[model samples]
Target: MSEFTNPGFEARFTLAQAETTPPEVLAKLAIDTHAKIRRAVALNPSTPIKSLLRLGKEFPNEIIENPIFFLLLLEDPESQFVRLSLARSTTTDEAKLIQLFEENDPDIRCAIAQNPNAPLSLLVRFVQESYQRYDDGSGTTEKVNRILRGFVQNPDTVASILEELAYLSDPELTQAVLQHPNVSETAIAIIQAMRGQRGIPSAILDQLVNHQHHYVRYVILAHPDLAPEHLLKLAEDTELYWDLLDRRETLPTLVIDRIAEKTFQILMSPAPALHAAEMIVLWIARHRNTSIALLQAFASNQPDYLYQHWGEQQFQNFRAAVARNSSTPTFVLRKLSRDLKAEVRDTAKTALRSRKLSES
Candidate 1:
């Protein structure tokens, strides 16, 4: 094998064999031992988790019951490259991997807890158990939050499980996950999990709108039974511009009870119907052949909100509508022209000037 092909091959294989071997092989295995790991961290810090991941699929049950993986991150040469290589590992090595991760040093356990690819069941157990371990109640909430962020990134976990975390009364964990970088669509599950449940208030849901993740915003919008306040926030979160744009057409007509109330309320809520109207107007500006029904829906829902907006294109649009269809009432044109928004008033004036010219 070319030397390039075998980068760190010996260490990888050595790490691999320790996971699979009998007690006899495990001891003889030339791995840098736990003491070695602790000492290494004095110079270079990293998660000391080599033993559990090295075994691949055949890790011994003994190793599973008591993992040696956590010690690796404690060492200086924290080459988690070997560990991260095993991130999505399907190796039947779970028992040993988790045993060490769950039972060992807090730092090792945390590395596992933070891992995006750690087994969901093991991660959840670790998260829950670690919370209890911090019994002094000192700052355990922060610990739980760290685990929630890990799970938030993995989309495949059970919804019920994610919701369980939502039920945790720690405002810190709930709010932390709401804003976590790895957080995305999971906020929807968290919100739904909060349904009718007593602990979380509606304000936290509003905070999700400020998240950089639009998919999380989109998920909040996808909820049919969202609170009026939360719906208002999502409907108006400028960060959700693309989300509303993509789902605008279907949302208005998507089958829901009390269709008018939901649609109208979503469009007129206090947060800023401007988000909904502006996005649609922007879309209409791009695709003039847009379905008139959807366009008309906006016309009916938030025309007042439209006049309040600060964009020139919005006014230009009202003017263009007048020119395109003569039946457009003159009074509607007059209201838009007399509008206080200078850009809008200017555009409306230009439209009236053009209309009078053509008629003459």
Candidate 2:
């Protein structure tokens, strides 16, 4: 037989690739002199974790791509070695990254933030979580800062995400973003111009709001000391409306009315609105801080056509959310108790009952 058809090589390759091969045999094959056989063992789903680890230094890519490696992660979710390897792997899927993110281990999340394969939505979520953790005093400032820095330094980080981070106004992170190769010159100029200003002057803020780039306007809107009039002005810009609604702790009653009106208009419009817009309306209805007037408005505004198009159950679900709001007025609860939908009526009744018990 020719050297190319060597039986020993073929036999080793078969054993390395076979799922039914014993772990000990795979472990032995992991060190095979032939690179192909060793690669096959690394790629084999049935390869023992110990053998995979042994082969990891030599064949890191093959080991990371192996299904068994992810299984090992599932088996030991806290294993730093496994989590870091998967987090740093460019081949790691978005779904897996998201799952790893849910673990809320800061280091793992930081790794994912910096990973090129991480989805944009997940990166946005990481930024939001980092901000929340920092605000709530739940996370150490050092760790939160590190996570933010990781997102800033990631090559895949987009302008929108950079905009959100810029809103934080962290000097160090701003510097990192300025230096990032992926960041545009315009963005760098904007950041440079805004840098070291203790509080943005009204004139400067006005100029920023009208600047061609939405990112410049976003930075102005996110300013810690942004004036109420400026906020109201920015709210008129539909592009920034959702961000304003999501980021602000308190909004003027007029702004809230505008949001409510827009929501109803979209639902009634001939064309479908983005699902995200509808979710914002839902969030407004369910938030405890939502104006009592708006909750009552949502509870009482039962348009027949809305029920017809949105489905009676779906329409009732929105009313039910309003009923669940702690700030919902008792009169509104009484009104909802008579709602045609049982869910709406039941939720309103429960809230009313809970109130009476609390008073007693």
lDDT of each structure? 0.46, 0.72
- How well is each residue in 1-360 modelled by candidate 2, as lDDT tens digits? 142233498888998898987777887888889999999998998887777766764676787788876787689866876876677677778888889988988778777776777788878777766546544546436766876887676786778687656545577888888777677654564465455344445665665666544555655666665676767677666667678777776676667667666666766788856456656767778777677877766676555555556665565777999989887888989999999988898999999999999999
- TM-scores of the candidates are 0.32, 0.43
Range of the 10 consecutive residues with the lowest summed lDDT in candidate 1: 38-47
TM-score of 2: 0.43
Candidate 1 global CA lDDT score: 0.46
Query: Which candidate leads the pack in lDDT?
Result: 2
In every candidate, how many clashes are there?
17, 0
Candidate 2 — which pairs collide?
A: none
For model 1 the TM-score comes to 0.32
Model 1 ranges with Cα > 4 A deviation: 1-76, 81-213, 245-315, 321-330, 334-360
Please name the candidate that would achieve the greatest TM-score relative to the true structure: 2
**What does each candidate score in C-alpha RMSD?**
15.1, 15.0
